[model samples]
Target: MKKPLQKSKIPSNKVFVIKELREAYLDKYWHSHEEYQLNVILKGRGTRYIGDHMKPFKEGDLVLTGPNLPHVWRCDNAYFDPESRLETHDIVIYFPESFLGKDSLQKDEFEEIRKLLARADRGLEIKGHTNKVVIKMMKELVHRQGGASIIGLLEILNVLAHSTELEPITQIDYKNNYTAHEKDKISEILEYVLHNFKNKITLKEVAELANMSESAFSRYFKARVNKSFSDFLGDVRISNARKLLQDEDLNISQVCYESGFPTISNFNKQFKDRIGKTPMAYKKDVIDSL
Candidate 1:
């Protein structure tokens, strides 16, 4: 899809920019930029969108996005409440391909970094120990200046290059091919669904939102997203259900209703189908992992 290519705003005198951001809510716009980005969410929980991939992101989530990969980190609805005190904190670094110098990365010694950057084209979520190390370096980076900051970035990249804990956020074959008009239509549809998925959503409602007939919208969405509308809606509901299930205070029945499923039987069956586990089992896993 056609995304806004924002300039990284790396100063004319600087090799890169390392900054700390605190926002009422993370930017929810769907867009892309020409510079590579490394981000660590210091405080937030939300749905992360990387190209075609959709997943929940939480505090300490570390991700690297290569140039031109459309993405967004949308905060949960609670953060948007008018009287809410919720805000997000992040450490973000943005740089261009030339940060490694014109010919430096071409050398065999820099092969790993080059490959890492290439892999980042699909967006990477740094996990486990690698995330910890990179995040540590990133925190220290904001305090460094001049030569020190540049060196700090290189060291972080080096650690990332050799790390085996990177997870690809999107599929390898995924590509953006929609025009601005179509992208706008799909974005609006998703925005509506995302905001209102807690309640029942019908095909006619979303189809009308996209200004298309029910059948037309179904075909268009399936062709571009590679999933049927009902499947996508189920995925959205399941995602929210997964989040709700993590809270011990919420029972399965509550999770089912809160996530928009009409019945516990349907919720359990669909949850198992998509998550490969029952809600109770998944909740147990979350507790164990903690």
Candidate 2:
């Protein structure tokens, strides 16, 4: 398979960039770049995949991802319709490690920022008041010039570096072996699984898709995510099933099959194991909330 690495360049006249993306939907390609990115979703909802983690995302979501950690945000199906009026808007900041200066991070005052960058290797979801403050700074930087922009960016980073409202997105031990070929392989597997998760998928099928032997794929996935492929699929299915259960029309049995489980018994067991409630009970809770 061809490498889908994203080769993004920053202008020599600029130390970093802050911009807004307004599109029919966010970019769906699973690609990586050479700069750390801070993103705030102004509008839209979708699924986000970063390194070894996959989760739902929505409006106002804020994330910081380290350089070259493969990631993508796949918008909901509604956004893809030409007849639909849906559009996504995002505010983003991109900077390389040397944005401030080549040796800037080595200074005593930059220790916290350096640590923040280290945490960013796993991708971070900024939360609470901190999320609001950083976003405000990002918006301010959009209209700032010269040193003002630099100070604005630094203020945002300083707030991030000192805040406790950051949630790491990937597993604690998630490795960053993001070689070009590895990015392509993982991106392919993610695409296949996400698009086909509602149907039966087999180890051999995904193995062939990645052009690796079944055993090799098994070992590779386990080493990276610390979980077997089947377990990962189960997590994905359960997550989707939770969403489906919110619909009053779909019963537990229907949700089970629609979420790719072969039998309701297995579905119930897995649901309770991961979600801490039986399918019926979970459905009842959703009903009660409404």
Candidate 3:
């Protein structure tokens, strides 16, 4: 059940590399690598999975991932529509922890950058105006080469180091051991839950999928995923409900039932608890932003 280990094909001569991805969607399976990653989504909205965290990601979403941290951005169903002509696009920058040399991060001049990189061990999301600045720098670097490209990366890291508009994306104590079998097992569970979350699910049912008794499955899942199965299912349902809420076609009750909550009252309670806003209010805010 282990997920694949994606060996990043960085050029041997380059200290860091940047690439632009334009496709129907990103790779499907969960994977990890040995390089730090800075990802900026230019055109896409979907579920983003990092470590044991899963949430929605849209355009302007900027995230920095520490080396060997597993991550993926799965595009929404609309993007795969034959008639929609939608495409997924993003800018990705990859560099090793010591890209600047073995002793560079230990130098006084790199103190801030070193700290920033260290915090990325839990993953970091660049936000607010800082996201804007870093995106611009990334764009510039995409078109530059040689010494200029390296300098651009330095500038981008410096800006990130000084920016306070950053949020940690993973748990404080999360560690990546890269257990392939367990990773694949969790990946399978995630895929099944995401696709079937709208239907009735029970602990016994999923336990069978993992080939364990309900009690054993519960402990195994909680230990590896850092959350109970019920909580994880609720999160998946709520995340999808948020997306459906933004659509003009669905009303509150429709979204509530469609998102797998058996009753509107239950959906309202869960929505408020998870999103910090009532469904209608959340919809209004998204519309206002538009």
How well is each residue in 54-113 modelled by candidate 1, as lDDT tens digits?
878889999999987877788888988858989999999999888867878889988999
Candidate 3, which segments miss by more than 4 Å at Cα? 1-3, 80-84
Stretches of candidate 2 exceeding 4 Å from the true structure? 1-3, 245-255, 278-290
lDDT (tens digit, per residue) of candidate 3 on 1-290? 44365667478888998999998876656777789999999998878889878888889989999987887787776776778888888999999988988888999999999999999998999999999999999988999999889999999999999999999999887777758677677777777776678899999989999999999999998887788999889888888888888898889999998889999999999999989999999999988898
lDDT of 2 at 22: 92
- Each model's lDDT: 0.86, 0.86, 0.86
- Cα TM-score per model: 0.92, 0.87, 0.92
Query: What is the C-alpha local distance difference test score of candidate 3?
Result: 0.86
Query: Candidates ranked by lDDT, best first?
Result: 3, 2, 1
How many clashing pairs per prediction, in order?
A: 0, 0, 3
lDDT of 2 at 282: 92
User: What value of lDDT does candidate 1 attain over all alpha carbons?
Assistant: 0.86
282: Cα error in model 1, Å: 0.8
Instruction: Assess the local accuracy of residue 281 in candidate 1 as a C-alpha lDDT between 0 and 100.
Output: 95
In model 1, the number of clashes is: 0
